[model samples]
Target: MTATAHETVRDAGRALGIPDPVTEAFVRLLRPCVYPCLYEQLPEESRKHAGPAARAGGSAHLPVDVVVPAYVPHLVTVDCAAIPTDVLDIDFPADGHVAILAEITDQDAGFAIHVPAGTETVERRPRETEPDALKPCASFPL
Candidate 1:
């Protein structure tokens, strides 16, 4: 039996240590905008680079930045990052238009997703409060 493009993506996500929920969300969100064939052709090396960062968050619901190499046709080497739904403030099953945030230059267009620290509900609370939470530790006398 042949694996569908979606399955390939899921497998890739698994190999990268991305949580199942985030991977499923990515597959569902990008299904309409991205071609199926592209998912099948996702490079192995790029997946390696993205895996560590994706898993660094350690939460299934946290938004992930999936950077696909040559995402746009004829734009080889210019990767595009897929923005997760949470970052865009979109709800599931809504069928809303997805946006790809890109930096376009004369030579190339590079897309990226920036999820600031402490933005997600799970990460909002600090694991351990410092003596001076508001100020940097370095600012105080040793």
Candidate 2:
């Protein structure tokens, strides 16, 4: 059974008992790999550039880990109202273990890069800059 991008990530995550924060990172990673399909499903104006290369083998490609870029704003945002504060408020021992908090803040603080499964890090890069999108593909802004 093939999993849609959203389903693939969700299933793998749930089965392994991945936490909510990690799951959000997975979704961000998935957007780049699957956004082209999403665009095709949208109207033409909504659909702009696709991606750098056609995905190999037509099977799914997903990124496992995302890193927090330096000095960037908003890696992810938490909707405090949505989740049960009782659970999200889970506490850590206060013996100077603040770095973990900082790391979480950093990863959730700015944009992220997602390298697809089976691909090397060097292959992933920022798409070209465009007025319509966050970063456009390399074509001199059409």
Candidate 3:
């Protein structure tokens, strides 16, 4: 029997040592956006530039941090409640991408989506503070 995409993602999360609750939440939140059929079912208002706003709100409340690790993206810290809802009006293309939301330290909380340029998988660890270093613990890929 073939493992469904959702199962595969769940397995990946387990293999990466992500906690069960965080993995489950990530899968739940990602289901609508990752699958085309599910994506199509979303309200029209949600399909337009909702990624950033959703990311901001979700990251602030949840213990998980969403990120695309292959691109080595930098974390963007912001106060979710302080973000204006008008951010949804910014026209940008966000398609065919899925992020992994992992439970990380409070200092590591942030958003980090990037256009993937390589195949390196993101590994989460305690972040070390350095003036010009890339912090890898902020995010990972699905």
Q: List the candidates ranked by lDDT, beginning with the highest.
A: 3, 1, 2
Report the poorest 10 consecutive residues by lDDT, candidate 1: 133-142
The deviation in Å at residue 53 for candidate 3 is: 28
lDDT by candidate, in order shown: 0.36, 0.34, 0.41
What would the TM-scores of all predictions be?
A: 0.23, 0.21, 0.22
Prediction RMSDs, each to the true structure: 19.0, 18.2, 16.6
Global CA lDDT computed for model 3: 0.41
Tens digits of per-residue lDDT, candidate 3, 90-119, equal: 433343222333334565543433323242
* Model 3: number of backbone collisions: 0
Candidate 2 per-residue lDDT, tens place, 24-112, comes to: 68676542311223234566775464332222211112233444332332222122222223422243222211111112343454232
Predicted candidate 1 versus true structure: per-residue lDDT over 51-138, tens digit per residue: 2111211112214344333222111111123323343433332222222332245756544333433434222212243332221111
